[model samples]
Target: MKITGDQQLIKKMNKTIVLDTIRQRQPLSRADISAAIGLNKATVSSLVSELIDSHLVTEMGPGESSGGRKPTLLHFNRSAGYAVGIDIRVNDLLAVLVDLEGHVLQEKTVPLADFTPEHVLEQIRKTIRQFSKKLPESPYGIVGIGIGVPGLVDDKSRVVSAPNLDWNQVDLYESLASEFGPNLHIDNEANAGAIGEKLYGAGREAQNLIYLSIGIGIGSGIIVGGELYRGTSNFSGEVGHMTVAENGPLCRCGNRGCWETLASEKALLDRAAKLWSDSHLDLEEIIQLARGGEPRAVQLLDEIGARLGVGLANLVNILNPELIVIGNRLSLAGDLLQDAMLRTIENRSLSYHRKKSGVAFANLGIRSTALGAASMPITMFLSEPDPALAQEGSPSAGL
Candidate 1:
């Protein structure tokens, strides 16, 4: 078959253009939208009407006109629907309910003593039930749920492998689909963290970014051209497992001298135990000690920061992202390690590549993964074609 006019695709694309314009420049008039998107007044008006009918956009009273009549202004209805985001870790779960505009309406952090699929699923269901009861009436209620897991997650939302949790090929979507409907989605925690930063944190202004989640085990989220880059099989950003030393400590991923084994929070804690001779100190205490100018703690941070830089040099040499966000629990170390990290990156990576990449700490803190999960539904909802407009011969037919 040969391609033709395909009016539906054109309309869909135009709809996105109009919707995006309205979202960016709220209280815009039809004329303003027309000028912004280079679409005619009639086309803009038609799309606006459709959006209004769909409860996505609203008409405000009026705005000052160029000369003649006052123009009615348009606004994106952020409360048109709600989305749920869940970030699952080995010992904790963070769940958030967000409106269409990515504002957290309600959130909860629950401690988890169990990692069994049944236990985790039950907790998720209960949390969703609790959150759903509090949601305000809207055109779409709980539109979708997104989960960020700290391990290998497939395109279909299955937990392919989470060695930390000892999970293997757990079909998370299948387990929850019957109770939650088909809106549930899942991704690797680092990928979700990257999304969270892209949407709400330090990476907001960056088109190309790398989110280094320096947690118990290290992981990464790669963003390219403002989109999450999940390479074939969704295993693109496992930079933590990248070898940094020819012969060093073994990593849980069955690798020797992996970056995470030297620079991750787990590695820091383990090393701290040997030097400090205090086995009971948590990461926070160590970070606090470092903040207060403890010599050993400070030295530990320098070592970890240097290791972080070594891995980052490799990333800089390869991707040269505009921004590299250091995130996750280890981010709490703050300036204790940042200077050393930057210095190492400066010394290691090639001059030109190093110049192109800027490093920053994640501003969203622990909320990154959960918030990123919530953002998925909003992005999907905006880009998805309306079912009512899904004609048999449409480009998005049966989708």
Candidate 2:
């Protein structure tokens, strides 16, 4: 009995070291892991044996021989576990499956109807079930679910306020938990976007970053010191409502002439539709017209970019981040929009901030929010767990 207990302890410790090794450094050889993790070669040999047996790690083909024989490289099996992420938007709900390394495996988009609270919730449930059906066989299938709602979200994932969705006091976490089990997290869309950029997108190495999401409306996610700064009420990055114009048009969030009222894509489209009221022309057509050097479309997009830059300048003044990631539908215009924004920012922002802050378009486009939502489960799981990870090598935490 004593021997068996000691063997068990050794086995668990070895596995922990191996797991830590594999997670921190990918595609390493057993010899490399043993050397890097400071575990005895023999101990690593035994633990890797067990990890391979459990399908957690696998040896790829082979690597070049160093001083000794060529050894097989080990990698975390991409299919070890899967996570589901949901992003709720006005037009659609996006669902995705992600692996441990935040690689999206499969994704689906479901068109939304009226977007009433109950209707949206029902759609979320149906789509989540649908997305989960695509997962491969795994011991810890669907580790958790993360929802990115386009609004102010409390730490609890509650919809503190989302005027676009007309949502308030909506317990997104509770509702999701009731249907999908307790491992559910909710966050505002912009926060999720920032997290996405940090983990899997352009802002991966940026400590102080701002993710400006220009979707139907404008919102931002601020990451300071490598963590999201959601403020006291979890409403820190709602830059859209900042009053650029005291006498601006009415905003849905009950603020008059907010920044978004003048510069958001929705606002621009509303203005464009009225100013150029040719029944045959549509929004995309207008964008195409500008892309083809049409005078009005080009002028309109430029003005929109300028207005957006004004908003960005204020944010740069307050938060001098290392990077500002511009993403969402409008970013699709590429330099056409960015040039105007840059020009305005140069004029409006202080020289120090203008020089320090670098602007990059969000390359992921519509997928930004969806990918952000999809990666949420993995982030939450890897970060602090609700009950804390079980003591080293305990079963209560992940295997």
Candidate 3:
């Protein structure tokens, strides 16, 4: 059946187009926006005015004169709003508050010895409050909060299960909403990491990319055609559980030798435990040792990288992504691990697959998850402003 567009919907679509045009081709004039968005000059002017009024866009006086006259140029006001993002893992929480342009305004990492839901939630709330206390004035203040959980998250952002953390049926989003308000989002840590890399890190230019979050456990986030592909059950990229060794040690998920059990940070630490009984030697220390030419450290990292490459080869053979970004704590291993990973990929994957996919370490480093999480709010504000915020008398009602 055919349907007609509502006047409001048409207006919103036009506004989005105009805003996107300005964002993509900034320092543009009315004529430029009109031509780029295919909107009439008058309509473009009205939308630009609305955007300016919303503090989402700004006028930069004038641009280089055409044959006729100089025109006022427009710029996207990235600092007009703010967002909060957090990455919750089994052992720690990383949180950041960022402006609309993806610059971190504030950040903190808290180690966790307790994995209880209440304890985790309290830590998150505390961090958010600390961030809120320092929020600078903006059109939108903490517009939304996005959290990345290292687990199976449903479409509604509920944690179905996180075997590593032993969490099941946890309503993280709902639990935080009462204190943080309605504008909260949650997703799998890998999925968040993928978008993080795509938006701000190594995968920025890659439309089809895979982000492998190799922390305590490995999780993947698939980006297809510049969009995240959340499967029917939102469990599409749980590649950690993909069995690689039939007789290998049993995984937390009851699987035998899942890829993560062999390649993840936990795996490295486990192997290192045999040589160095010091519990204080972190992944970073191990990587430093490997880089320093320590024989045992180098050998352990090679094994980890090879296992990681095996799983990556499986992904490359099937998906053929343009890039595969390895992030999370294990990424700290740097070239010491990546060289071995590339060698294994070259040996294990088909020539076609090996040549097509480029493996890279995450450029965003540890901030990937927090930045990506914060982007959710920035995205929502830019793409769809809250009606309440736009209403009269709201703090963010006017630019």
Candidate 4:
């Protein structure tokens, strides 16, 4: 019997669903998946068989059975392929090679002395080559690459603007697609961080959450109903540009009173510079000083935390997210900033809103963006009906 297009599509989708189920609840019998997803045992078995043929799922020894013969358990083949995730920061680029399960196999931090697009692109290419050289043997080596840019990435994966990197209208997808195949994703760094936290970190259990990347600038990734909510122009979470203080300091965006100018790590360093003119104290040094009970450093953190809280309270009042994850460089100062930040939120946000909202630092530390970025290509590759198509530009394919 010839299958129609609709039937083929449905079969492909069902196969994908089965693979996802196995990945999420691995080491489970085929019967468990059929029961869990309400599919018939025959259909589940067929899909699982297809997944196994595609090398995306594997079968283990028989498991204990409630009745009759024991059932063999199925597991997602995490080592079937690999992906590269890159997070472009103002001063450095963080790259990670991760398995299909988002497990980091290798990681590298490349310092960026130049913010020019050409230079950064070269660095990215070099890093990917290095990762390819060190990759472990797998069926689909280096399936694809995902990049988190510290700027506005359009729907077409174009870097519309990255103030920190001095980039505008940079088409990274076009630059890398020739060598990496079509499965490339470029998104705002904060958006990537939000996804990272949602899938594997602090926001895992919360459907609605916000990931705030507070480093040189404060950016946010808003997850509504477990999905990133990109605005009309794919520039939804520019919270740093929100005006908090009417006559506050100037921002790199040529705006006064922007939230980042007062709440971001840059803001903290700026204030610290004024207080300790003789010492060039970075965020780490200031945090260390605060930890050692330095009165001035403590006060400086308190002020920055209060400012951060002001913006956070506004976010809570407006979005009412279940959780707020603070990430990036500023999160390293979480210990010193918690009290004053919470206090400001308590005084500012609506009581009802604050009650349901919990604020926490990123559980993945500074690797949130990198891991999240890596997951994108893996997701795209796994979603393909034919796994071979996903391996077109992989290193194992001689690309």
Number of clashes in every candidate structure? 0, 1, 0, 0
Q: Write the per-residue lDDT of candidate 3 for residues 288-389, one digit (tens) a residue.
A: 888899998899999988888899889989899999998998887868888778888888889987787899999998778778888886676677633345
Global lDDT scores for all candidate models: 0.86, 0.77, 0.84, 0.92
> Judged by lDDT relative to the true structure, which candidate is superior, 1 or 2?
1
RMSD of each: 3.9, 4.9, 2.8, 1.3
Query: What are the runs in model 2 whose C-alpha is more than 4 Å off?
Result: 1-21, 34-54, 278-283, 380-399
Best by TM-score: 4
Clashing pairs in 3: none
lDDT of 2 by residue, 1-399 (tens): 999999877766567667768877988898899789788889788778877876667888788898778888888876766777777887888777788776777888889868888888888777666666665777566767778888888777778788888887898776656556555678888888888887778898899999988878889889999998989988888888899998889888788989989887787788787777865454567788898998888998889989989998998888888999987767777677888889999999999977888888875666666667757655444443221231232111222
Compared with the true structure, model 1 gives a TM-score of: 0.93
Model 4 bad stretches (over 4 Å):
1-3, 395-399
Top model number, lDDT: 4
List the candidates ranked by TM-score, beginning with the highest.
4, 3, 1, 2
Q: Give the range where candidate 4 is weakest over 10 consecutive residues by summed lDDT.
A: 390-399
Q: Candidate 1 on 326-389: residue-level lDDT in tens?
A: 8888898867889899999999999999887899988988888988988886777677557233
TM-score of each: 0.93, 0.86, 0.94, 0.98
